[model samples]
Every structure is written in structure tokens, then in C-alpha cells.
Target: MSTEQPQSGDPTGMAGPVTDDARLFPPLQGRAVPVAQDRWERLVSAVDIPQPPEAVWAALTDPGRVAHWFGVCRGNWARADCEVMLDFEDGEFFWCRIQQNSAPTADHPGRLRYLWRWVGIGPVTSVTWTVAASEGGTSVTVVEEAVNPPSDWRSWNGMGWPGILDQLAAHLRTGTTWRWPWRRMGPYLQVPLPAPPFQAWEALTAPGAVRHWLQPCAGSLAVDDEMTVVMGDASGCALLKVTRLVDSGQEFPSYLPYLEFELRRPRWPAPLAGRIWIEPVGLHESLLQVFQSGWEGVGIPAAVVERRILTGYWTSAAARAQMLLRPPGAQAPPIGPHGWSLSGGDDG
Candidate 1:
């Protein structure tokens, strides 16, 4: 009796494709060509609930009820190859087609995996939902895999899963729906600076200084042949080892540059690897930008934490610069919108 649409495709709410060319960028070079024959890319998101698997399964299968939790459900809710519309209250919608759905088997119960191809997009995205009955309740896992999406798509999707999963968990807990109505955390941060000058201001490149500013706890630092800084933090630390360093002099994009790191701790939530860019505004001033994706485990929104950490890093860097130039008793000036501060030494 639930109003939720069935996991299978339905026909009543079907609509034409919504194609917006501006939002879809041209495919990256070699993206159309299969990168590998056995390329099996997957992104996994999971949440623990204190509810039974059957309850979660009902929510997953009911179209009208699912709409309450995610968004408005339109289209036939009972067949494959049917268009599914997720219409938001803000008058926005994403069009997807069901590609595959697998029922629970002996090894797995209450598991559903389906392919979702967005209208006008190049690649079809695969989403897998698995429910396991545990001692307390059920643990639900959602995995999404996109094929050769642009960098922007990957970045946005990376930060988006946590919020969505959070809503899913809340719905399961209270039998009510939840929606994320805020802007993504990444675009809100604006760090302006040129690449070359920023690279020159790499005072933190030194192992001693990196340990002092970035890594508070015990860790090792190493620079690779490409001049990337590799760092590891204390045990059970969420922060991964810093792997790459770029000179601001390079003609990179105005956004955060790509970074590579090796994760030692397993418990650190999503965002296993990505890039970070730092721009030096002045001799002692710099702006930091981070673009990361991928999660090792579930829980805790990584994008929110990354933004907070980046803000702190910038603030600390400014303070460090002031301390280096100014003498004792000299007051530090306020950081400007562009991340620069006074560079004169105090005469106290």
C-alpha cells in the first residue's frame, strides 16, 4: 500500500529527455575509447540502520514513497529501459534510464543494482543498493559507477554522495524523507593566486616546516623525483599522506590542481585521493584549493571536513608568514580577501 514507486519501471510519469548541452562537456580525449577491457570502476556508499531489511526493501521498491525521500517520482515504475525522473522542489530534475536490476540471492538478500543513464550524458552510471540484516538492524550500501565522466562531474559526484546517503539513512530511521538543499562546499571556496609565484612560496616544502604546519602528530615526509611531497600522519589519523606538490608557475586551471596520495589509514571516510592547488598572492601570502574524490569507508562527510581543514591551513599559513617577517610585539594584520597580509617587520 506504500505510495513509493516500484523498483521496476512504470509508464504513467514518463517524459521526454531533458538535454542541456551546456552542462555536458565534450568527452575528454581517449574517454570514449574504453580505457581497458576489464575496467570495472565502482564507487560505494553505505549507512547503518536499526531497521529490518524488509522495511528498507519496501522503501526501495515503492515509487511514491521513494519520491518522498529522494524527490518526485515520475514515469512507469515497473519495467527496465524506462525513463525515471527525479524532480526536485527547486524545479530541477535529472533523467535516468534503468539498465539492470538484480534481486537478492543466496549470498545476498535485499540487494539491487541498476544502471542509470542520464539524459544527454555520454556514459551510463551504475548504482547498486545492498541491504544486509545485522545483529541490530540492516546495513544499506549504495555504489555508483560512472564511465569516463569529466573532471567536474567526478568532483561534484564525489562530494555529493555523503549528503545523499545521510538523507537515505534518516529516511530509513524515521520513515520520513530528507533533502539536501544547499550548495556544494567546493564551489563556495574561492582561492585566487598565480601558479608560479605560489610555487616559489613553498616554505612548507621543508620536512621540518611541513611537520610543523601540516602534520601536528608524528609522520614522515619524502619528496619524489617529480618534486611531490609525500607525508604520513599519526596512527588512525583521517588525513592521508600528502603526495604531490606543484609550482604555482605552471599554467594550470584557476581551480584546485589534481593531487595524488597514498592512504595508510582505512577508517578515513570517502575522498581517498584527488588534487590540491596552492597559489601565492605575495612573497609570504598564498591561497589553498583542494579537489579530492573517492572514499575508503563510509560515514562522516569528507568534503565538509576538507573545506574546514583547508581554511585552517590558509589561516595558519598567513600567521606563519607574519611571524617570519615581523619582530616581537608587532601585531599581525588581517588577512585580505585575496589571502595577503602585511609583510613588514615590527620595530618594537
Candidate 2:
């Protein structure tokens, strides 16, 4: 899903650091909390592992070890400004630039800082990882910070860290890694629209137009409106509640409108929270940024099943929306022969 051109050298990037002995650490619980101060909001999560600092540091910097817990990381982090790519298998891939990578010193713990961006959509944020010695082992902490984040920013980014850190602990302890069940820890997707902002926004929010692409809705898309969504199969009712609404010119004229909503279905353990921002690329073009996260409390297998069903639903909806927005006889850019699925979907 990364649109950037390939780098010039080292197509595979550098191999991960290796050590002769891979130590096993006993697992312990981790914690995550959202911090808001001044203009910035940050997610902080930490976990303690019963392993030495050197072993934990190796697991943190080594791509091979990282993949066991996090994702497939491709980059040379020996210096600053290195282009880093982390692909979280299901179509969730991210490209960032490392701002700093500092090894542990006698006086301080090891730290890494990177500017996280997803190929031109959504706000850029900073992610920092720290490794320090704990009472009996090592403590690893991850912090992600952004200025003026979305309404559900904390849940979108914070919900998955405890699980992620648990996986990390499992990796260091068992030498085997299980797939992380949750998928909505960050921005879900961003796609270009062939129409202007007005057209795209109308197609996304207007009840009549929305029915052509998304499911049928019983009420308007106004703030605090609790609408009942008619599912394709009509098995049960789906509920949608609008939480926040911001038009482009009302606050930030140059920016597109932002909408936040909470969706609930009969079978879901928790409501799915979503945020949409329609950015005007030009007078006749726009970009849609979508963020979603929630309802993964049901372990790995059940979560995977839910994700598969939702993937198909969202893919078909997006394709229909694109068709509705396209100008007559004008071909939009080729998405794919199989249809445009979300980057994290199996079809994608």
C-alpha cells in the first residue's frame, strides 16, 4: 500500500542484528495511557521483561527479532534520516523517517525516534521507543505523540499497545510469535477521489447519496444523530451515532471537513469508532482519510473472522463510492482488477 517509489540502493535493506545467544525473558503485564499536555497528545505504553538490557535492546533493534512481535521492518537504522518501512501484514504498511537512533549509554537508556507518516494522508506523528534496565530485567516503553489528533485518537492508537507489548514479551520469552489479533490501532486507509471536496463529502454523508454506496440509513448525518443502518442481509439493525462534525471553512478553511462516528452491531463486542477527513487535492480532486479501531477484545481467531467480514463490506462500499464520484466516461485511476480492498484486507 506504500505509494512511494523504491529506494535507490539495497532493495532488501540491511539484515537485522544478530547475537549468538537469544535469551528468554519471563513475561509480565504492560500498561498504556494517553497523555495530553499543551498542544500535543501522546500514547505511552511500557512493559517489563525478565531479561537483561542488552538482550531487550537487541530484540528492539534487530529486524528479525522485531518481526516476531511487531511487523516486517525494512530499514538501515545506523544513522538519522533513514527511511524505514514497517509492514503489518494484512495491508497495514507504514513508511517513516528515523529522526534519532541512540544506543544505550552508561548514563541513559537506548532510545529511538521516528516521524510516522502514511504516504501523504493523515497527520504526521512522532514515535519513540526506549529501553532501560528495570529492577530485575529490562523495561521497554513506546510513546506516540501528535498535535491536534482526531477525536478517537487514543482508542485508535492506544488500544493495541498492550497486546503488542504482550507479543513482544512472548517473543522474548518463548521464541515463537503469534499474530496480533487487532488491526485498527492506527489509520485504516486513505484513497484518492475523482471528485471535488463538495461532491465527495455529499456522497459520503448525504442520506440519499450514501445509500447508493454505503448501507441505507434512517436519519441525517447531523451531530448527535443516532441513525439506524439497514444491513445488506437485513439480519439485524446497525446503529450509528455522530459524535463530532467539522466543516472545512468553519474552523480550518484550507483543511477538509472531519466527521467522527460510533457504529454498533448486534453481534459486536464493542462499537466500532471511525473518523473521516476529506482533503481537497485540487479543485476537481480530493483525498479521503479514514481511521477506525475497536471490537477486538474477543481473542485472535474471532477477531480474524470479524476482520474478514468487515474487509469485504468496506471494500465494496469504497468501490461503489468511487463509481458514484467518477465523472461520466472518465476513468479513475486503476485500483486493481480484483477490486479496491483496504490495504490490510486479504484481497488487497
Question: In TM-score terms, which candidate is top?
Answer: 2
Candidate 1 per-residue lDDT over residues 1-348, each given as its tens digit: 768563345464333232355347665666554223223356677778787777777777678767867767677542466766655533234455665455544367665655553311224567777778877887878888764333354465674366676776788777675566443322112232322333424544555655443433555544232222212222123345657654444544664333455433343444345455444333333444444344323244554444333333333433443344344576755645333222121101
Q: What is the C-alpha local distance difference test score of each model?
A: 0.48, 0.66
What lDDT is obtained when candidate 2 is compared to the true structure? 0.66
lDDT of 1 at 203: 46
RMSD of 1: 24.6
TM-score of every model versus the real structure = 0.40, 0.50
Which stretches of model 1 miss by more than 4 angstroms?
A: 1-41, 102-107, 119-122, 182-250, 253-348
